[model samples]
Target: MNGDWLTRGRDGRLSVYQLSGEAVRCRAERAPGGPWTAPRQVGGDQRLHPFLALGQGADGYVHLVSWRPTVKGEAGLVHSTHFRPRLAALDWNPVGHPDKKGDRTGPPAVAVDAQGRAHVFVRNKAGGVSMLAQKEKGGWDPWRDLGGEDVHDGLAAVTGESGRIELYAAVPGGVLHWRQEEPGARPVRQEPLRAPVRPGTLYALATSADRTTLFHTGTEGELCAWRPGDKPVTLLDSAGHGPVSAVRCELDGHDCTLLAQRSASGRVAFAAYPTEQESAGAWWTESGPRLTVDARVCLATDEDGRVVAATLSPSTGQLLLTRRKDEPGLALEAWREV
Candidate 1:
């Protein structure tokens, strides 16, 4: 499962780099077979932080959201836009004003359903979560609340097999998940399914192939998995290194989980576990090579089942991408600085 990396260049321009053969090669424009020009800057301020870029639907539209911090360090929405291939000469624009008076919104998570409708999830400083969607008719819908009235830490959105939408979040006390039949159904229902008993913050949450099982990691350095008919299991306890920073998709033809965690000394380590076992049932096994980089790592998987691990160099702060070898076991490609 090879994937590409996208980040803002030193000059404030969006840059694309392809991860292949354990090396990252810069693509002059976007990824090959992608738009010729990289995504345009959404806001005037080049100092804005680049959160994440979401792929467009079959209609050839890509979506992105980013923010700029205020004088006091509060993030404010700067721009959110939909890129259409037809509008090659166009630039991104800010979406609706979804944040409240003093609340700031986080980077948006984009999801494109089977119908080619775009669904975006945004988190606010007020602990609220909102969902915005673009219908097939080419109209932007109103922002709808999904977090209920609680404070949420992080938000994630994914499209299921039947094009159903699943939204997950880490709230103050536990994790919450909601699903809908369509892009804009009132979330159908919301439930707090997993509670991290240890002392730590929940950093990330991901689902298995069936989307029936959910996995999460907390600040206490423990990894947990939850399923419909089973109790929440602790797959791995970090001891004290801190929570798992990143998790990739399920490996091809295996019921296993792959995750990247920050150690006590801040080094990043990769671990894999069987998907069907409980956290306590199956001993969390560490697979692949350990990366001793300075900064935290992020995990991305391509459609073909390749995994790309990325982190910033602690010494120079330059981004690094490592491609794991395409083997049955955990074999990693060489690490290269992008």
Candidate 2:
């Protein structure tokens, strides 16, 4: 029931993933924007945390990762792959703890490169960043330390326009970042951006082929948008306390970025604006009924090139989804329980 729960595959089928009873389950559309199928268990065990990180590559394979406590009571990471639209996920495989002593780890963040390899990142027990990457041929490389100290959990990773992976984590007084100079090359640490970002609220959107813009709630209780080498710009004053979900697509025949987040009143709010043009301003409009103040809202593009927003119901925990209406600017269809 995390924010990163929706994805679309190569065959134009949209899949919604959820974590229930420590097992990952999926409900996919029978066709693009069609009726959704029944829930099917995909992977996970009792040790799994409620968090799930999902990423899809150019080849349409969906990669999912989550944190689990090992038998030794130390935090560990497990990974699974969905090769096709309707196929069951591959068995959950341990990504292994960076520390042999099995020191507890944090939730994982993942991104798939252009070549279809999924790169996984997590906060190590020592408050630093560690990475494990999928090999070009097959198999995974040994866990490598990307190096950052005093870092918080809730890491964010995205594939850049050049197909290289970039990583970001919230630190005490600012944000730490890592970027690959070229596709398939090692990602090296970059200059950290100074901002008082709320931990567990770091979310990234690849606004363009090569550029990415980050959206998060600031420590001062405002929503901020930031790009590397640019100052953090405030987007909203009271964006609640959790993560902000964003997706980039064309709206009303114009390129735009759509964002969804819980408001201070415990309601999900939606906003749209020109991509990467935060200074032009964005207007936040309340959508759907009030949710818990901490509820997570997710935005993703469906197979039919329409925007979709998904969130969990407070009473029933059912997955509720709404789609962008065909007529106008930033309008959405009524919320439907899937």
Candidate 3:
């Protein structure tokens, strides 16, 4: 719920709010023991998209991906890039020095593993999803095709408990998965997880702790889940007319899921579902009270069963973080912007 908590790590180091609301103000410090350092700007004038953060596995190195307006060969393009985490006095220099020659109108998702490697997922104009990863030893690898030969909007990635990497993309017709055994290896595509036949699109994908199940939603205002063997099941359905963005994590020591979707009136409402099964089962159940927050926001999770959400208050255009009190049996805890 600290909607403003920019990025958090499993080790309890958090880079959180510090400066002008329009830009990202982040500071790195140990959680549960912090006198958080002075906040610093990570993305210069870039105006980063939601969910940017310092990747896990590397010390003092952060990875950022953003879509900025640009002119490309007489046409307009949105360029995305990755930056390294540095001190404010150092002016936030980019770590890997990657070339800025790509399109970014589509949503681009980034993930950094335990080795400080950078993995990027973006949908190109050709309607195909492409991935670019940077290894500590090698530079940026060539862009590889991810499936779905159509426009894709939402992308999510996570490192599983087994250390294998999994990626989810919301493509034109449905959702797709990519799994890799190790770094620099080819990713194998799982079957397409089709979205509902309603008039919505899949916007986000989050996995359970085991990484075997996935949760997703789209413009149709429905929250659904997909496991390895079963068909996608609708968890929460909304009569509204906008897309739904979702985040999943453990809350209060139990599996928790959060689904946020825009209503017909443009207000964003979030629903929470708690894990009902002790082992892998059919579906997650709604446990706690539903909460609504600012519409234009993003969500993330930390290791301690805490949820970090980013939302811009339309009244002020300033970013805010909502921190929820932690409680047992609760699947998700909101962070307040205290």
Candidate 2 C-alpha lDDT tens digits along 118-139: 8988777778988889999988
Over 128-170, each residue of candidate 3 has an lDDT whose tens digit, in order, gives 6776777668566667776666545555565555545677766
Model 2 scores worst on lDDT over the 10 consecutive residues at: 311-320
Expressed as tens digits, the lDDT of each residue in 1-338 for candidate 1 is 00113433222223343322222223222442233353233323345544543533444344454444455645544333334322331233445545643435655666666677767777654567777777668777777776554545345555665566776666656767778855456565565665653322333333454455555665565667665446666676662343344444556566565667655554556776665544324333333334454345556554345666666443453555565677766677776655
* Model 1 TM-score, all chains together: 0.68
Ranking by lDDT: 2, 1, 3
Off by over 4 Å in 2: 1-3, 44-47, 101-103
How far is 151's C-alpha from truth in model 2 (Å)? 0.8
| Winning model by lDDT | 2
TM-scores, all candidates, are: 0.68, 0.94, 0.66
Q: Which candidate's TM-score is highest?
A: 2
